[model samples]
Target: MMRSILQVPAEVLSELHATCKLTPYELKLIGELCEILEPFEEATDKCQGDQVVTASYVTACVQGLSHAIAHIRETYKSKFVVTKQSSLGKCLAKFEDMECFQMAATLDPRFKLNS
Candidate 1:
C-alpha cells in the first residue's frame, strides 16, 4: 500500500490536492505515509546497522518526493493553478523546507541559498 501511494501519479495527485476535495482515503494515505515512512527513508539510508533513526534519512526521502511533486505542479502550473492553499501543499512544503535546510546546512559556511 505504501508503494501504491508512492506510485500515485505526481501530476494527478498534485491536481487533486490543488482543486479537488480530499477523500478520506487520500488524507489517511498521507498521514500513514508520514507516520510510517518519511522520517527514516529520506534522512538516513545508511544505518551501519547501528543508528536507529536519523533526520537526514527522512529529509532525503522527502526532498526527492518534493522535486517530483513540485516538478509535476510546475509543469502544469498554468493549466492547473490552485487559488488557495491545500493541506497537501502544506505537507509538501514541509518536505521542501527540510530539503532546503538540509542543503543549506551541508554547504560551506560562505554559501547562500538562492531562494
Candidate 2:
C-alpha cells in the first residue's frame, strides 16, 4: 500500500499530503522497526514452512530477536527513549519471560548443549 501510494503521481501525493505525509523522523523510526523485526519475520517464516522445524529453533529465534531488540534499544535510546515500550519491546517482554523455550532448544539434538 505504501509502495502503491508512493508510485502515484507526485500531484496525487501532494493532494493527499496531509494524510500521507511522513516526516524524516517517522521514516527513520519505520526503518528502525523494519530492521529490528526482520529476524523475527524470517524466524516466523522458517517455523511456518512445510519442512520440519525443530522445537530447538524456538529458543534460537527468540534469543536472536531479543538481541536485535536490545541492539535497537541501545542504539536509539538516546534519541527515542520514550518509545522503548514500542512493538519490539512488547514482543520481547512477552517472550523473554518464557524460560521453557531455552530448555526445549537445549534438548533438541540440533541445538544440543552448545545452544
Candidate 3:
C-alpha cells in the first residue's frame, strides 16, 4: 500500500488532497520501511498453506528473517529502520533459544547440523 502511494506523482497526490502530499523524507522513510518489512512478509507467505509446515521449516524461516534483518540494519541508513530491526531481532531471538526449534533444524537434512 505504501509502495503504491510512492509510485503516485506529486501532482496526483496534491490533486487528491492538500494533505496527501508526502515530503521527500517521508517517501524515503516509507520506502525504507517497505524494504525492512519485505522479509517478514515473505516469511508469512511461506508459512501459509493447506499442507502442514514443519518446525524445521519455521526455524529456517526465522533464521532467514534474522539474516535479512541484520543485513538491513548494517546497510540501511535509516535510524528508525535500524531501531525497528533491533526490536525484530529481539523478538526472533526467543525462537532461537527454543530447544524444539533448535533440535528440529539440526535434524532436518536441509539444514547444516550445528555442533
Candidate 4:
C-alpha cells in the first residue's frame, strides 16, 4: 500500500488534499522501509505456499533473511540507520540460539555446502 501511495504523483496527492502530499523525508523513509521489509515479505510468501515447508526450508529462509538484513545494514546510510541496526540486532537475538534451525540449515541440500 505504501508503495502504491508512493507511486502517485505529488501533484495528484496535493490535488486530492492539501495535507495528503508526502514530504521528501517521508518519501525517502517509506522507500527505505519497503527495501528493508522486502526480504521478510519474500520469506512470508515462500512459507505460505501450498507445498510442504519443512524445518530445513524455514531455516534456510531465516538464514537468507539474516544475510539480507546484514547487507542492508552495511550498504545503506540513511535516517533509518538506527532502525536498521535495531532490526538486525533483534533478528540475531531471536535466532542466534536456535540450534535446531542451525542444524536444519546445515542438513538442507541447498545450503549444505554453502559458506
Candidate 5:
C-alpha cells in the first residue's frame, strides 16, 4: 500500500501533495525501516508454534536482531540519515547484556544437551 501510494503519478500527487502523505525522503526512510525490522518479524514468526516452546529463541533472536541492525547501519551508508534518534541502536542496547537470555537458550534441551 505504501509503495503503491508512493508510486502514484506526479500529476496526481501535485494535486494532493498538501494532504496526500509522505515526502520522498519519508517514503525511502520507511522502506529502509522495514528492511531493518525484517529480522525481528521473522523471529516473531518463528516463535509462533504450538508444538514447541520458543524460549530458546530469546538469545538467538537478540543476536539475529543485533546483526541485522549492524548490517543496516553498514549497508545504509549514511549514518546521519539512518541513525538519527535510532530505534535500532536502542534495541541493540537492550540486548547488550542478555546473559539471562543466553542462560535460557543454553538450558533448552533441543539445543544440544539432552541428557
Candidate 6:
C-alpha cells in the first residue's frame, strides 16, 4: 500500500489514501510532510538520485497524509443534531433525542421511514 501511493499525483494519492486508518500522531506527521512537499509538489525533479525511488518516497509520504485525514474523520464520527423546544413551561419538558444522526441511523422499527 505504501509503495503504491508514491508514483501517483496528489489527486491520485488522495484517492489511494482514502483507505488509510490514522492515529492522531500520524495526522500531525502527514501535515508536516505535506508542508515540506507543498512547494516541490509540482516542481521539476532536480535531484541526482534514482527518479523512480524518489517518486516512490514522495508518494508514500503523501499517502500518509491522506490516511490521516480519513482517520480523523472516522475517529470523529459525523453527528446529526435534532432540536425541538420543550413546552414544559406549558405542560412538560418531555422530548426525545431522535434527531441525532447515530440515533437516526438506527431508527427503531417503530419509526416509519420518511421519504
Best to worst by TM-score, what's the order? 3, 4, 5, 2, 1, 6
* Model 4 lDDT tens row, 1-115: 9889789887877678565567889988888788888887897776566765455566666667778877887767665755755765676456645887668767777654845
Cα error, candidate 4, residue 39 (Å):
0.9
Please report, in order, the local distance difference test score of every candidate based on alpha carbons: 0.49, 0.60, 0.79, 0.72, 0.67, 0.37
Give the lowest summed-lDDT range of ten residues in model 3: 47-56
Q: What would the per-residue lDDT of candidate 1 be over residues 1-115, giving only the tens digit for each residue?
A: 5666556766677677465755668767565545444433543353223543334344444555545445545534533223212334666457546655466445634435487
Query: The CA-based lDDT of model 2 is what?
Result: 0.60
Q: Which of candidates 1 and 3 is the stronger one according to TM-score? A: 3
Best by TM-score: 3
Q: In every candidate, how many clashes are there? A: 10, 0, 0, 0, 0, 2
| Total clashing pairs in model 5 | 0
In Å, residue 6's CA in model 4 sits off its true spot by 1.6
Q: What's every prediction's RMSD, in angstroms? A: 12.4, 5.0, 3.2, 3.5, 4.9, 22.1
* lDDT: worst 10-residue window of model 2: 1-10
Model 2 bad stretches (over 4 Å): 1-23, 78-109, 112-115
lDDT of 5 by residue, 55-103 (tens): 6776677667667766767777776436632665576456546777667
Candidate 1 ranges with C-alpha deviation above 4 Å: 1-51, 72-86, 95-115
Which is better, 2 or 6, measured by TM-score? 2
- Cα lDDT tens digits, model 6, 1-115, are 3323343455554555566755557555555445444433433252225543333233323334344434444443433100101121122111122234225334544335588
TM-score of 1: 0.27
| Candidate 4: count of backbone clashes, pairs at least 3 residues apart or interchain | 0
In candidate 6, what residue range of length 10 has the lowest lDDT sum?
A: 80-89
